[model samples]
Target: MTLGFGEGRAFGYAGCNRYFSGYTLRGNRLDLGTPGSTKRYCEGEGGEVERAFLPLLAHPFILQREGEHMRLIASDGTRLEFEAAAMESRYP
Candidate 1:
């Protein structure tokens, strides 16, 4: 299953590692594509998490939005956790 977040809703991770994939609905499933990222890396705190973060987003995530958080879980047991920010978003 996929997710539908709607238009004008920009998505990114905790540390401003943003993505350019727009959200759309195809029937009951949401289609996500065109994921682009910046080559820069953060070397400080949560860096390992950051390192783990990007590579884990290899495929389009099946998403679900909660009251405040968006939970993204993959089939490989890799879970990407992003706190819901009023100005930011994340998915795996």
Candidate 2:
């Protein structure tokens, strides 16, 4: 999974589909609006992943960063971690 933030928006490839939402950050708390995604039906593991992952975005989460790693901790104590990816230029 990949997530990117820019211009008060959050967007990413959410396992089976691309998703986008408006976001607000206050200190370490991050809140995201309802996400919009392409209507694509995925099967098997992808489908299971999508179902489990998308709902996590609905609730606000605490953001933590350490070096190249970032973690999002939900109110229920569920944590999701991500590492920074190599930057790729959009124009080449």
Candidate 3:
């Protein structure tokens, strides 16, 4: 997945769909506003990951970065890990 955050906006491709949301961050805590995304169901794991990912974005999560990796830690300790991807590489 690819994530971009700036100017109170968060947008990215969540495995299958592209999503945009409002966000606010203070220190280590981050709150995500309701996200809207394109409605395109992907086959197999892509669709399933999208379904699980959307709701996770609706709540508060912690952002941690280590080297080239980023982790989004949910309130319940569920962690979503991401790595920086080149813009030239397309998502499946």
Number of the predicted model whose lDDT against the real structure is largest? 2
- Model 2, 60: alpha-carbon shift in Å? 0.7
Q: What TM-score, to 2 decimals, does candidate 3 have?
A: 0.83
Ordered by TM-score, highest first, the candidates read 2, 3, 1
RMSD of each: 5.6, 3.2, 3.3
Candidate 2, residue 65: Cα displacement in angstroms equals 0.6
lDDT of 2 by residue, 1-92 (tens): 76778766787777888888889989999998878887799998887888888888999999999998989999999998889986322211
What lDDT tens digits, residue by residue, belong to model 3 across residues 1-92? 67777556788888898888889889988888988888886988988888888888888989899998889898899998888766532222
Candidate 1 lDDT tens digits, 36-77: 655566676555655655455555555666786666667665
Cα lDDT for residue 83, model 1? 61
Q: What is the lDDT of residue 82 in candidate 2?
A: 85
Candidate 2 vs candidate 3, lDDT winner = 2
User: Where is model 3 poorest over a 10-residue stretch in terms of lDDT?
Assistant: 83-92
lDDT for each candidate structure: 0.51, 0.82, 0.81
**TM-scores for all predictions:** 0.53, 0.89, 0.83
Q: What's model 3's lDDT at 9?
A: 78
- The clash count of every prediction, one per candidate, is 0, 0, 0
Using TM-score, give the best candidate's number. 2
lDDT score of residue 44 within candidate 3: 86
